[model samples]
Target: MDINNALKADPAPLGLAGFGLTTFLLSFVNAGILSGSAVNVVMPLAFAYGGFAQLLTGAFEMRRGNTFGFTAFTSYGSFWFFYAFLVIFNDLKIISIPGKALGIALILWGLFTLYMWSGTFRLNLALFLTFLFLWLAFIVLGFGSYYSIIELTRLGGIFGFLTAFFAVYTSFGIVNNSLKPGTIPLGPAILK
Candidate 1:
């Protein structure tokens, strides 16, 4: 059996699932649905699914010549790793980060996502909306963290959940479509 043939599987579903699951857990924490020790749960998922899995997916996307997926997945994968590091540091008292600093970091990510979101206008509707929600979520979350505003943070969490939901749908759709071509519609491409 040719080893190359083993790598031909679609990577989008895996990438989307990683992003969706991690985002869902983190959003729940942000939404205050899980308090106290519950926040601890996201650390592992962030590093494993969001970080490593997405990074692998990005590598696969690169192999397929999907620059958009490669860039987005790898970038977000790195983001998750860094985020996990921050949490670990703070949790362990190795380094205490100010809320404003965290806000700044989040805002910077939002800025990057804004540009990515613009690019998504060329993709399908599901992907476009996913990036849209994610971009808004980062902005809202950053501002809320900076100002210690609970309501805005909650709103951001809501947006995060929306982002996750869309990601999940897109992932599953891709999976179904791959299994049986055109079985799931991802909507028309906006740019083509």
Candidate 2:
């Protein structure tokens, strides 16, 4: 038996779902579809699916030797965990994070995501679009907080919703392609 030949399921779907669901839920809050207090509704999902499950997905991706999947899943997992902690803390009044601080964090994340977005040029269109929208979402959210603009936040929510939608679409593509190659088109890799 060749250990290298052992069957292992793809981890991308789980990672994408973790990202998509959490983004969708939080987008609702950001878009004002749900009250800001409704962030509580997202906390548990963030910890379970977005935090733990995506981290596990990243470990599996590492086992599969996919550096991008490993990095994206693990980093985003940590993002969800930290985000939940921040929300919970604020909800409980354990500490307060200034709007500027949150804005700075969002800007930093946007920069990081922008870097990742370039790498996705070598990937598929679906993933590339996902990162692109995500980057835009982060930028919009950052400016919203920094400027105290509700309209920007609402725009961010629209971009975030697109990001989540693309994530879900990419996840579906991964699963369907795995089950039956060419069953769903992810578009050709652009890099090469």
List TM-scores for all candidates, in order.
0.95, 0.95
Residue 19, model 2: Cα distance from true site in angstroms: 0.4
lDDT of 2 at 152: 94
Model 2: per-residue Cα lDDT over 1-192, one tens digit each: 776654377889989999999999999999989999898989999999989999999998999999988999999999999999999998889989899899889989999999989989999999999999999999999999988899999999999999999999999999999889999888877788
Model 2 — TM-score against the truth?
0.95
Model 2 pairs in collision:
none
lDDT (Cα) of model 2: 0.92
- Report per-prediction Cα RMSD to one decimal: 1.2, 1.7
Off by over 4 Å in 1: none
